[model samples]
Target: MKQFTSIAALTGLISLANAHGFVTSPTARMPGDAMASACGQQVEVNQQSDNYGNIQGELQVASGQSDYSASECDIWLCKGYKFADNKDNVYSYTAGQTVDFTVDIRAPHTGVANVSVVETSSNSVIGSPLISWSVYASTATGVTANETDFSVTMPDDLGSKCSTAGDCVLQWYWYAESIDQTYESCVDFTLGGSGSSSGSGSGSSSSSSSSSSSSTAKAETTPAAVETTSAAVETTAAAAETTTAAPVETTPAAPVQYATTTFATQARQSAEPSVEVQTASAVETTGSSVVSTKPIPTDGTAQEKLNFVESILKYLAN
Candidate 1:
């Protein structure tokens, strides 16, 4: 009975072991370690516990190796360990986990003639993953062999998942060509806590604001001038009518006959001296020089009568 009880206990232990499948904790195992390692690269891993209650690790290459180094193995081991421990769902790793990531570079619709990149987040860029970035000529298959990768330290606030919190996104922008003009393409990497995705920074122009203000100023300044011009036109029209009326009243009614008559009367008065001589001669010849002499001749001509009377007065005084 004792033996049977011991066997039962052993059986229970076996069942429990079977239920919790055995997992090989990631360690520096020779060939496998080498295979898992990456040189001058960036890697990511998603780790989850399987139905057999064993931790399973799957490696993903976030960036590719441009050069080989000892640090790459270290990165691979660290990534594997993290997966085994199930510490985080998203992991960012540098160096190790030998895998190649292909990045296809495209010119903007405007296009780019050349491009350069810099790390806004990492400082160990020299001889690191940040320096290993590859450049490539764009093609139908992908970017040409000019592309490379480099190492960089991940920011503390990026790549973590969250329900309400947010993350810092690492951005990479490259200039390329389209139709011989330069254009830009950008990619973003998120870090430290996640929710819904968000974007980065932007730039703006004050020219639009200036244009709006100028339009408003023009509208404000023009209306008064237009009104003044209209008022001036009205005033000029009224003045022109008054001027036209005055000229009509002053200019049209005098006669040519009256002017000629006045001229003839003045001429006769000027000839009075000659008329006196003629009257004196007549008086001498007729001896009938009645001192008044019929007041000289007045045949219904007032101008001639006045002249004859003046001549008689002159003769009598002499």
Candidate 2:
């Protein structure tokens, strides 16, 4: 009986090791009723059991389930987590805001990883990945600190594409080729000040608040000028209203986020378009591992290596 207990414990450890990683902070979407309806009950159950389980593991369960709908499941995207189920957990962010991410990696698997804003309707990346690592969670080097804790700045040029909660997601994608496992976690978000109407409204509110504050201060300074100031304030308010009423037209090109590690999209070539990374002196390829042209010191801790790589990538981007 003691021998049998030992075997059971070993089996449980192996089961735990089979699954790998998931985003822990910013409240990533989890499998739910909506996901069950789309990806089938078995697939949903699989994820519910181990949220860190990869896409390949979910697919293995999906293959035998008759309820799994390929189109509806979208297994390759966000590990098939549905926006409908995650509606209550959407994040509201302004353009150029910085979002910090924390991932819990149960086990290390050498992979390529990136975080990007994805358009849910079409399942395409909105410009480029906010952060990327070509050699991520390497077995040789083990998992690095930055690999689990990182921050990304939201792009200002998303326009109105991500203005709605369900329209887009900040997705973290990791593909481990050695194990043929893909793990994804999505953070539903809406980019504020992107829509013309909403932007104009916010501008108007800010202007009105500033005008009110200024008028109050002026009134406090000179009681005699109260009447004259009120008249001037009315005129200013009228002008501000007129200015805000007119439609604001803006046509700005989307900007790309540069990282030391090239964004790997090759594993997703069939689903996404090729992304190009160019430096002042050299050009890097997408969907594959990127190596720095300069010699990097190999004599440092994992954190130092990450810092050095970032410095090199910044130099190259500039």
Q: Pick the candidate with the highest lDDT.
A: 2
Error of model 2, residue 233, in angstroms:
50
**Model 2 per-residue lDDT tens digits across residues 37-147:** 999976777777678888877776677778999999998889999988876566666565566788888878888999999999999999989999999999999999999
Q: Lowest-lDDT window of 10 residues in candidate 1? A: 21-30
What local lDDT does model 1 show for residue 236?
A: 43
Give the runs in model 2 whose Cα sits over 4 Å from its true position. 1-17, 194-318
Candidate 2 weakest lDDT stretch, 10 residues: 198-207
TM-score to native of every candidate shown: 0.17, 0.57
How displaced is residue 142 in candidate 1, in Å? 9.5
Deviation in Å, model 1, residue 138 alpha carbon: 6.9
Tell me the tens digit of each residue's lDDT in model 1 across 108-198.
1221222122122231111222223233234443443534232223322322231111121112223233222121111111222222111
The reply for model 1, stretches above 4 Å from the true place, is 1-100, 105-129, 132-142, 146-166, 177-318
lDDT of candidate 2 at residue 48, scale 0 to 100: 74
Global lDDT scores for all candidate models: 0.27, 0.68
